[model samples]
Target: MVASIHPSLFDRMVKLRRDLHRHPELSREEHRTTDRLVSELERLGLECQRPLDTGLVAEIPGASDAPTVAIRADIDALPIHEETGLPYASDVPGVMHACGHDAHAAMLVGAAELLMSRPEPPPAPIRLIFQPAEELGIGARSMIEAGVLDGVGAIFGGHVDRHYPTGTVVAVSGPVNASTDGFRISISGQQGHAARPHETVDAVVAGSLIVMAVQTIVSREIDPTHPSVVSIGRFEAGTASNVIAGTAVLSGTIRAQEPAVRAHLHRSISRICESVGQLHEADIQLEIEEGTPPLVNQGPMVEVARRAASEALGPERVRTMVRGANMGGEDFSWYLQEVPGCYVRLGARLADSAGYPAHSSRFQIDEAVLPAGAAWLAEVAVQGGRELATGMVDDLEAAGRAS
Candidate 1:
């Protein structure tokens, strides 16, 4: 099925992807990247809307809003510098396409082209959502606020997965990615001379104790069956040697798949911080900032995506996730909250050697997966659009009889 994609179109995608990789942009700053996408999408004679400062919404007319099925692709880079040494490496110093968002946007455009060239439109319109700020964990919500989901019935999206080999796609039915939320602990106490140990309430000691206590939240407070994480990524205390610091701070993130586990982690962290502070005679303040929710694919939408993968690349190539649910967070969950949709991982691993993971300076994907990703996305749009249109018609009929 991949071979059926015109060689010229595939080559165009490869070249354009390299161009994007050459000059990458960070979250919410994808102006150049946005311009390039707008040009290509307009050339295909599709309607375009710049719903956000960067990124766009390209619409391909079909049966006139019969039931708009959406396909989303993120288009933001990372802060890491390029280390892959490819000829098309990042041109901007200290910035790179470390997460394969470049490839994502490229393949999405390829899908748009393939759909545009069809002899006739599908049973419904298709909305191509080129979103920015995905790395900030807010792009999906930003687009939704801009009315991207207006009149939309179903949506489909995917990410490049290095764990699986190229030519394969993993479509999971539920709980694919975990929720991400962050917390900060501030400790305040007395400061005094180093010699006056009893005179000072050492915040450093209190902060250290708090960090250790935070670890027990996942291990003891939460159920062992439900996987959760409490990681203190940053800790600050003490100003200089031989000084009892009066203030300290600890910051970290929380990851959990289930709602109960997520809430439990938050509660346990607060309890641990307060208890530790009281034990050490220090004032403790805790703040938790909510981020994206866990991505749980609906069963019916998963079937649509899985069948699309099978039809696009053959039934043998389509597969389910081999590992358990991942702890990583994706804002795509925000879209699923608004409407039913399916999210899959597009395999891009080239060899057994474990290459640099996403967000690494050396991160990269197998370019060969470009066309495969495109084909899968295009197929899902066609299949999902038809289903949504039929359902919409059925609903209208039921309403008419009642009226």
Candidate 2:
């Protein structure tokens, strides 16, 4: 299936990917990245529109005015120094395309090129969304606000996963990613000398207890079958070794695959803090910042995506997430809330070295995945568009029969 892509187009996509890698930009600051994409997309005769300050929305008109099937790719970099010694490494200091957004954008551009280069127009309209600020988990929402999904029937998107070997596409039909929420806990206690511990409340001890208590929320309270996480990534307290810390701060992320579980995790955290504070006779406060929702791919959308994957790559190459749902957060889930969409994981694992995780300084992907990923995107958009058109026709026929 990969051999179907022209060698020249593949080379161009590789060049574009490396160029993006060399000059990576952070979220909402993808001006140069956006410019590069516009240049490439416009070169294919696709009319592009800037719906936001740093992202683009372009369309390839179809044979009819059917609702557009949107294909999205995030174009944001991370705050990590490049560790890979490749010649095309990031030139910017303390910034890199650690999460493969460069590849995503390039593949999406390749998909656009392929779609436009076809001899005949697509069966239905296609919308290409080059989005920004996905790392901050708000880009999709902003694009929706800008009317990107106004007439869109279904959307398709994917990420480059280093865990799977290149050529495999995970197009499963259930929960793929979890909701990400952040929390901060503040505990206030009376300050005193370490020798006179009886006279004052120890915030460090209370904070420690709270941390250990929250860990039990998933293990004891929630069902073992359900996937959830409450982790305290940061804890701060105590200015001096001998001084009893009067105040402490703890912050971390909360992830859940179900709404009931998400709410339960939040409630449990608050309950633990309050109970621990009362036990220690200290004041405790907790603040929760809600983030992206759990990304559950609709069954019908997954079927469309799976068929597309099978067509783009062989059926043997189409796979599902071996390990249950991913606990990481994805803002693409925001789009699923408004309309049906499927977000798959494109295998981009490098065969040479044991791959590093996304957001790592040494993260990398197999360039071969670019063409295959682009092909999958193109196929999915066409199939999704056709599905929507067929369903619309069926609905009309049913109405006519009733009348």
Candidate 3:
């Protein structure tokens, strides 16, 4: 079932991906990228709408009222400067396709072309979402707010991973990514000369203590069975070497796989900071900003993905996760909260030792997987449509029997 993409389509995908890579744009600033996508989609005979300033959504028509499934590809680049040195390296200064989003967008375009190339329209309707600002973890939510998923029944999104070899897919059914939240601690005290330490509340000492104590939230407060992370990324205090600092600010992120664990970490963080502040006699204020929830793949959608993957690339290449975990955050979870969906991790890793992870300046993808990814998404839509259609039949039969 899973064969290579047509030669002409594959050639177009490579060229488009390289062109996008060379002209990388930052989050919320993808005007050029969006225009490129609109042009390509329109050339394929599909009408696209630009609801936001930077992203676009195009629907592939199918039978009337057929179940709708969507395939999303983020179209944003990171702030990292290019270091890959490839001919297609980013031309934009301080911005590069470090996260494989260029490939994501191109593969989605390839998927659209593949579907259109078919002799008949899809069994189900399909929506292609080219979203921006994904690096900031707000694109998915913002797109949803703009009504991208209005009539959508199921959705699927994927990230290119360097961990596994090309032609591999991770179709896990449980929580694969963590929920991310952030915390800020502000401490106030009296300023005084360094020689007179006793005159100041010593905010630096208090903030330092808070940072060290916050570390214990994951190790001591939470259950050891669950995975979590709490790391202080920034700390600012004091203005001079000779003066005692009167104020300090600390900022960091929080991650967890379980809701209880996420809540527990938040509670523990506040308690620890407050306790340290009281113990030091410094006024402390804690602020928590929650981010996206965990990417928990629905069982049925996972089944759809797995079945489609097997049909597209063979069962041996489809890997279903069991007990492993990742602490990274993905905005795709926002869509899952509103609809049943699956988040897939396609293997784009190459054999080179210089291989770097996503968001790294040296990160690169094996271009060969572009067609595979496109084919996989199309198969999922077809299989998902058939599955839903079958379930609908079963429901009607059961209702008839009851009557």
* Candidate 1 similarity to native, TM-score: 0.96
lDDT of each: 0.89, 0.93, 0.87
Pick by TM-score: 1 or 2, better one: 2
In model 3, what is the error at residue 317, expressed in angstroms?
A: 1.1
Give me the candidate number with maximum TM-score.
2
Candidate number with greatest lDDT: 2
RMSD of each: 1.7, 1.5, 1.9
| Candidate 3 or 2, higher TM-score | 2
Q: Over 4 Å off in model 2, which ranges?
A: 1-3
RMSD of 1: 1.7
Model 1: residue 390 alpha-carbon error in angstroms: 1.8
Q: Enumerate residue pairs that collide in model 1.
A: none
Model 2 lDDT, residue 69, Cα: 94
Q: What does candidate 3's lDDT look like per residue over 1-403, in tens digits?
A: 1347778888898999999999999999999999999999999999999888999999998654656888999999999998989998999999999988999999899989988888987777889999999889899999999999998888988888777667778898778899999889999988999999998899899998988888787888788888999999999999999999999999999999888889999899889877987898889999999899877886698889988888888888898653376789888999999988888988787778335878888888888778878888878877776666676678889999999
lDDT of 1: 0.89
Q: Note the clash tally of each candidate.
A: 0, 0, 0
Worst 10 residues of 3 by lDDT: 319-328
Model 1 misplaced stretches (Cα beyond 4 Å): 1-3, 400-403
Provide TM-scores for the models: 0.96, 0.96, 0.95
